[model samples]
Target: MSGPVDAELARVVRDHAGRLAASLVHLVGDFSAAEDLVQEAIEAAVRTWPVEGIPERPDAWLYTVARRRGLDVLRREKRHREKLTGVSWPTEPEPDDRLRLIFTCCHPALPRAAQVALTLRVVCGLTTAQIAKALVVRESAVARRITRAKQKISDAAIPYRIPGPDELPARLDEVLTVIYLLFNEGYLSSGGDRAQSRDLTDDAEFLAALLHRLMPTEPEVAGLLSLIRLHRARAAARFDENDEIVQLQRQDRSLWDHAAIAEAGRSIARAASYRRPGPYQLQAAIAACHAEAPSWEDTDWTQIAVLYDMLVHLAASPVTALHRAIALRYVQGPAEALAAVDELESSLAEYHLWHATRAELLRELGRRDDAQQADARALALTANPAERSLLRERLNWT
Candidate 1:
């Protein structure tokens, strides 16, 4: 408790660091330069906090210092002439560069992997080592990638503005995918010891909410919000006290968050009103069905299967097919599910969920030994200890 003060102080510093970078980069149009401003601002805070105490708005305070440091950096380089009195920079914060600062970090022009890392680093304020760990890469590799990416972006003169209407479609999909991909990592981690990467989930939700504010009327944005809310409503029941994975039927319905469920309902209605019928909207509908059902027996498996079928057609990813197969197992029975699973085995060989689902279906069909073996294979494949433990528990059912 004695040192909690320092922790709180650190939080204040970290919270404003990304915004500091965003503003600095917008003013200077340089990545490493903006980061330097943030570092200097942090260093200043560390030195000043014990002397001046925390300010009323630490963020505003950080912005002031970071801006000054940025100006100082410019002055040192003799570049202040760009802002001669007749052509002085505006006193108001540059919202356009701030927007582009985030968009560029997750820009579709960059590789998806690069987008994820940079978003976490520049926008989420994560350190390169933390980002490397999050992405399961070595710290040195992450450091090099970050350096190269920033240099390339600055060299290529990636514009610092939101996409225009003509350029929105392709860029938007990549942005949405990266956001959801981060959320997925948090919801049900594809790797690591934790059952869910709460940090990643929080970051994804933060970005999605930011996007919703930026594009309020956009149906796809509403779809993503709805989908995340509906899924998050079930978070309380995703695992049990023993940390075992709680299958939907076995989960406690009373634990679901009614407020979040209602929010998701409003979002779903908002998206459906658009009549766009995109992937996120369809997925939200599936979530809505599960949320609306009163009990396991009352759940609309048929409707969910249909949604998955639609998703398979639209996205055509192995992940979607895997979900559709699981839904079929519920609606059409284990034999049908097995046939669907068989189709995904080759492409999804490393996908632990696919193996786990197949094991369950096989067990339900009285193929005990095969079920046990499949479960074992899935347990071996997952780095998530929580998921692995859940698979082991399922194996015991054999």
Candidate 2:
């Protein structure tokens, strides 16, 4: 029961909400008040814009309405009267407000879950229900986490600006982790009907580039960019013409983006020159090895395995070990890789990839029946539609 005007308004509001909110927070120095103003502006738009027709500058209209609303509140409160006189509202958000907002939301003071939820809500402009769906958590839990995070920010008076150079390295890493996770989710969506969603990955890449421009000297920043670019380079060949997932070995490398791959190489070289062997740096190096290969058989699996060894040593996680096992399968042999995977059975019991890996190894060893069982187990454990389809195809082949 809405017209074109209403639909346009909704699109504009969703696209610009985070930037508007961030600008409001910077101007008013209050997170809760800024969010409230934005909600009020949206309400006003819904009530009036559809009938009046949409404005040419919708973002400016929203910001002006929110600023006026803030001014009205301050005018009525005697204590905030002087503060209102000093305010200078911008016609649009500053170029860096979104980035600053992300850093503030991902502050180390907040719990990791709260940090992620807050960033997705306040910086990504996702609704609680949308975030809950993406995270596979209850809506109530997401709401509570966001509420507590905002309350903590208010109570602690967390500054609404980017940290200085001395603190930037540590804080930037946290921000990078969140962005990369967002990209990964988009790259291989866990629950959506489609295999990929370009919107999330596009946003993440935009943010990553922004961070690199802001802190060009940080090696990990370059490394993160390198990692993302390398993945993006191969995006064209990830799925077949039928939209079915294509295995890496079967993908047509000619479909890859040569320019992006070359840029990734430059980024990796720059990161290496800094002499900081971080997890991202090592991972990028591994990715570079694959990008540089002319064909699957030409890949330097030995170098990749060595890089994973370094990565596992730096950050000992089940995921890293799993990746290392994959590299081992290429360099050492099916038997050695199978042994490594077996050792992780207890730790990765519910993880679909573990079973999938085991199935591949078993298939290589000519244990067709065992491989079929492992593929069935993997299909059961995974919720992703694309992954399920791949597993089903493999199972049928067995």
Candidate 3:
């Protein structure tokens, strides 16, 4: 392939492969089978595109080809008849292939990890490397996990259609979690020194916005929208003029996007109007506490502490608990916060955030030497240059 042709093929593959795979999984009723079929289709495309040029509806073409290839494999393996009993393919293509696929991959029958990995791979178009990085696992580990997930999808006889309203509420959490993780991975670039992780943020926004549009009355959808929009408002300020990391307290608030902040407030208010609060809403509320504060001193650490307290009940994650500790120190004073931190020290021993928070709390309590040691420990756990740089700078403050 020539340089331009290869580049074009790569672009098309990157852009549409995941969506195609999702559609195929929906059609074929097996995530693993769908991945194999999609890869086979892309191989065909690589050969065809170099000769016949690119097609107009490459994504649809991919979906069509992958589905056919999947059927062929099943037929050759003599499982087509049994698989045919499981699902009835439509004579005509559905209008919302991607949405149908999303619902299928997020089916309540699948394990949470399988749902997340499949969604990140097929819906978000992330490579195994990127997905592994996002999940903080090795690439080979992610590959093996994905392979097994697909096999389980086939063996467990999972359906390939959107669920009824009764199943929607229960399945919605996994979907939202996948969307949030995708956004965060993009925002932080997960495990990388790359200048930026594209599409991770964009795909997240697109998925969140699509959900908001599809379920206009769903408060949780609004909560997720608010969470992503508000967090992204400061994405610009997270890095400095030289692309180094800047602490949230030190970030130039002036550089934060007012428009994104406004949108977040709108979503948060919309979700609040529903009278049923959720994790995203509570987290967005905490973010709002930070965004609305005129200065670090003016920050509503007290309210943030309250919000985190609520979040602990809603989400029950150690990360949230650690965050709450930081806010508690600011509100009830360092001693109470240190107590809270110590309670979580064992749970968060390996998390960089824990050490960073521990160091800050120790410094607040006038234990400079211990605080410095904690900061160094925290820095040691970091792989992100921006975060590492920020932590190192904090160490020099001693």
For all predictions, the C-alpha RMSD in Å is: 3.9, 4.2, 5.0
Candidate 1: worst-modelled 10 consecutive residues by lDDT: 81-90
lDDT of each: 0.74, 0.78, 0.74
Candidate 1: the clashing residue pairs are: none
* Cα displacement (Å) at residue 47, model 3: 9.7
After the best TM-score superposition of candidate 2, give how far the Cα of residue 161 lies from its true spot, in angstroms: 5.0
Model 3, span 1-398: residue lDDT tens: 22555546656775677566655555555566767777677777766877898998787676667666766778865564355345433334443566666776676666667677777666655566656755667878777767776776678876666667988787777688878877876677632365533336666876788678767888988888888888788887787667787778988999898878877887798789989999988988889888877788899887898899899998898889888888887788889988988898778899888999889888978999999999999999987777887788899977
Instruction: Give the deviation of candidate 1 from the true structure as CA RMSD.
Output: 3.9
lDDT per residue (tens digit) for residues 249-339 in model 1? 8888899998899888888888778787789989988988888788888889999998898888888999889889988887888899899
Q: Worst lDDT window (10 residues) for model 2? A: 190-199
Worst 10 residues of 3 by lDDT: 86-95
Judging by lDDT against the true structure, name the best candidate: 2
The TM-score-based order of candidates, best leading, equals 1, 2, 3
lDDT of 2: 0.78
In model 1, state the lDDT of residue 40. Answer: 63
Q: Identify the runs in model 2 with alpha carbons over 4 angstroms from their true place.
A: 1-19, 38-59, 72-75, 78-100, 127-141, 156-169, 190-198
